[model samples]
Target: MESSFSYKQTVPSEWVDYNGHMNDAEYNRAFSLATDAFIDHIGLDAKGREQYQYTIFTLETHTCYLKEMHEGKEFEVVARVFDYDAKRIHLFLTMYNADGEVVSTLEEMLMGMDQDEGRPAPFPDLVAEKVEAEYKVNAGEDTPKQVGRTIGIRRK
Candidate 1:
């Protein structure tokens, strides 16, 4: 129910590319950081993962660059659990600039995995409950219009 403000950072100079904007890969890096924080919030934190040998693996990702971001820009990511089941989570995140303009969006599919067996696994009971509760809290959220879009040009 609370706003899920998970990650924040200033765009580093090293992230800028020849065109003078943050590089494509750097967006991914930012998203990854936000995702880590979200999972930890839901109880699959680093210490628990190491103790249980369980973790979430990103199965797929889609990113939409809605606006260009430059070095020195401060930004933050807000995440929502969108949907989930016992073994998988469908997640979405939006990156916003300091002035609150939308900069980018990311959709990701992640699967819980058992490191010992190297296979998919259901989330631990507590984690599953937390995820479902978070999903319910986010149920009123309008799915971002950019979600589920494929990269292609409209033919004239």
Candidate 2:
């Protein structure tokens, strides 16, 4: 969560809840938008996906809220490539407040899907190269605490 983020967003009125802060669902929406931006960064925007007949699909996500975000407040997100293979990827996205503090985190598992075949598929060569670049860029950084968390109830 300490790495610098490249994507930023300002909280909107619609995202505010009766509690006078951004709602839980709105946090997910923001993260989803960031994910789309990451897809574009990897050169798999709509047009590129069409050419490759492939796209990344979110298979699972775990979110952890660490701080409050009010409407009109600016936030940032950095998507780090936690791990990946030919067909699957685990991404760690950290959300930060204007003061550069961790506000939230989302760890998502994604899969490459072949639209033409309607099944799981390997990332195309170009995309694979990009992903490896991402991995290499973040490999030296420490893994966030929220990564790979399992939900459960503690026994006393």
Candidate 3:
């Protein structure tokens, strides 16, 4: 029911790269943790997933790293539902540093999977409803500029 899902953590020293800031991989790691929290928001905890034999998979992801983060720095990842249907969700996750500035953002497409069949599947009715409700609350204004960017060098 809260507007969006959030996960917070401090950047461990191991996550830092030779450049002396957080590694690029750790930004994806933080967003991955945020997706776990988002799944819980839609009612698919470990018990529920086991009971329903359902799980979510990331179909694709686009990450834009806008700032640097050093070791031991605190950060928060916020997950928002850009859109969703019966089987898939377009999620936008943003990372904010301790001073509350946007440092990186990741946009991902996730699909529900039927574990037994090992294939994509629609979400359970309850989960679908919960996602729709959250989507309504999350798809408000001030959309992230990085939501749908493609990697390319703009020319001409």
Candidate 4:
């Protein structure tokens, strides 16, 4: 619940594309790892899965590639909760290179679901409380434009 939750990862060779940089898919992978870390921080993990039968599924995502990353590069991902309702949460993630420069940013919308029914459901009360606490603790001082954004082409 600090300003950001950080996770370190090494770029794998398979993540490199013909362009010789980390492929677009790997960006999502890194963000996904960060998401998992957040979930764990809030007490959601294999045990939560077994007991609550609840999990998050990504509904939408927007990623901006600001700089290229290469295979074997050590990088870090910082994630924070931007917003949340009963069933959905908005998260912002920044991928940083070894030098701490932001290499990419991703915004994602995730929905809590009942794994058995595959239907949307409100987050469990305990999980909801934890998430709310985290949001309060981590909300950034500056209002980031990425929060509550919709995908579209801008008209100049």
Per residue, candidate 1 scores C-alpha lDDT tens digits across 6-72 of 6889999999999999999999999998999988988889887987789999999999988999999
lDDT of 3 by residue, 16-80 (tens): 99999999998888888888988988889998899899999999999999999999989988777
Candidate with the larger lDDT of 1 and 4: 1
List, residue by residue over 57-147, the lDDT tens digit for candidate 2. 9999999999999989999999899999998889899899999899999999989999999999999999999888888878877777898
In model 1, what is the error at residue 126, expressed in angstroms? 1.1
- For model 4, residues 16-96, the per-residue Cα lDDT tens digits are 999999998988888888888877766678899778999888898888888999989999887777789998888888888
Off by over 4 Å in 2: 1-5
Candidate 4 Cα misplacement greater than 4 A, ranges: 1-4, 148-156
| Local distance difference test values of all predictions, in order | 0.89, 0.90, 0.88, 0.83
Question: TM-score of every model?
Answer: 0.93, 0.95, 0.94, 0.86
Ranking by lDDT, best first?
Answer: 2, 1, 3, 4
Report the Cα lDDT for residue 145, model 3. 80
Q: What is the alpha-carbon lDDT for the whole of candidate 2?
A: 0.90
